[model samples]
Target: MDLYTFLYDLATGPLLWISFLTFIIGSLFRAGLYIMASRKMDKVTHEHFSLKYVFLGLVRWILPINRSVKKNPVFTILGYIFHICLIVVPIWYVGHISLWEDSRFGWTWTAIPDEWADYMTLTFLAIAVFFLLRRIFSKDIRLISTFSDYLLLVVTALPFLTGYFLSHGTLENVSFFGENMELIHMLCGELMLILIPFTKLSHFILFFFSRGATAVEFGRRGYSV
Candidate 1:
């Protein structure tokens, strides 16, 4: 096979599977490590843990009922929008749903309209740029930011950008590094999945545990987090 076909097959087949498996296994391993460390270093957190407090904490933060939300309403709203679009658009896009239906499992689900997916993708990209600017311009945030922080933002945004291009045929006639836009999109998505477990994106899995533990600790003292 030629290079393009080879790359396309690799991206859609083995590499894709490897990325998914790595994400799942790595996330579980990280979670296991966190549990072990927490149990060993902070016995009190578990000893006094309350499921009620954990649930409450998750609800408070998940909604806009927290102090942080109150203090930074704009940022909070943008964050929610970004996350929602980030999650919803990918899972609900017509193209993605079709792929699922065509897969060996033949899973199928209703998808959002193509127009809606387009709008959401644009919104996601806009918010990603906003976040990058915030990190660069906000003095306090900048002070705490590292190279990895900026890199993660770019990594997170690239798949969406490339996907948008692929969907709209934005660069269909152009080839970069001997690869088409679809290949780039696939690679970016796979790279993101691979990185999620190792990067701050792992918060997708760890957020509940960390937030719940904090809530329990504070709740035991008659406080809210």
Candidate 2:
């Protein structure tokens, strides 16, 4: 098979299923492990369990002017943009939502205009660049950043860059890889899905758990008062 045909088949068939399964199973495994670890760490009775603080913790994180914002307001805003686009663009883009409906759900809803999704993708790309630069130039961040940290940024940004290229036909005039950019974009996206559970991208899962745990601890303290 030619490069384009091979890429298309690999991206849409085996890689898609492999990535989705890996994401689902790995996320469940990680969440289960967190719950088990939490049980071991705190042996409180079920009667004392309250979700009040957990809800509150989520609110705290979602709202601005908290600890994360205080640490660095600019970075916090950028983070919010990155995360918001990460969620909004995928689930709400017309093409993507249509794909979901066709593939599994058989249901479709109104999507944000393609123009807005394009703008959001640009914003996400900008944030990724800023993050990479911060990790490089900031002494404290540089000290803590592992090689995987940089790799993570690259992997996360790859799909957006390639997708933009595909949409704009930015590389179509080129001979070697231009024709295959769409498949490359799909491959990058699938790879990102598979990597999420194994890498710091697991923050998507752990963020909730960590906040919940903190809230539970706070709840216990409140009960004593």
lDDT of each: 0.92, 0.85
lDDT of 1 by residue, 1-225 (tens): 999899999999999899989999999998999999999987999999889999999999899889988899999999999999999998999998888899997999889998999999999999999999999999999999999999999999999999999888887666672348888889999999999999999999899889999999999989865
Candidate 2 displacement at residue 98 in angstroms: 2.9
Error of 1 at 199 (Å): 1.0
- List candidate 1 stretches off by more than 4 Å: 175-179
lDDT of 2 by residue, 79-191 (tens): 88898998898778887788878986588889999999899999999999999999999999999999999999999899888878877888998976586787888989999
Candidate 1 global lDDT: 0.92
Predicted structure with the largest TM-score when compared to the true one: 1
Total clashes for model 2 = 0
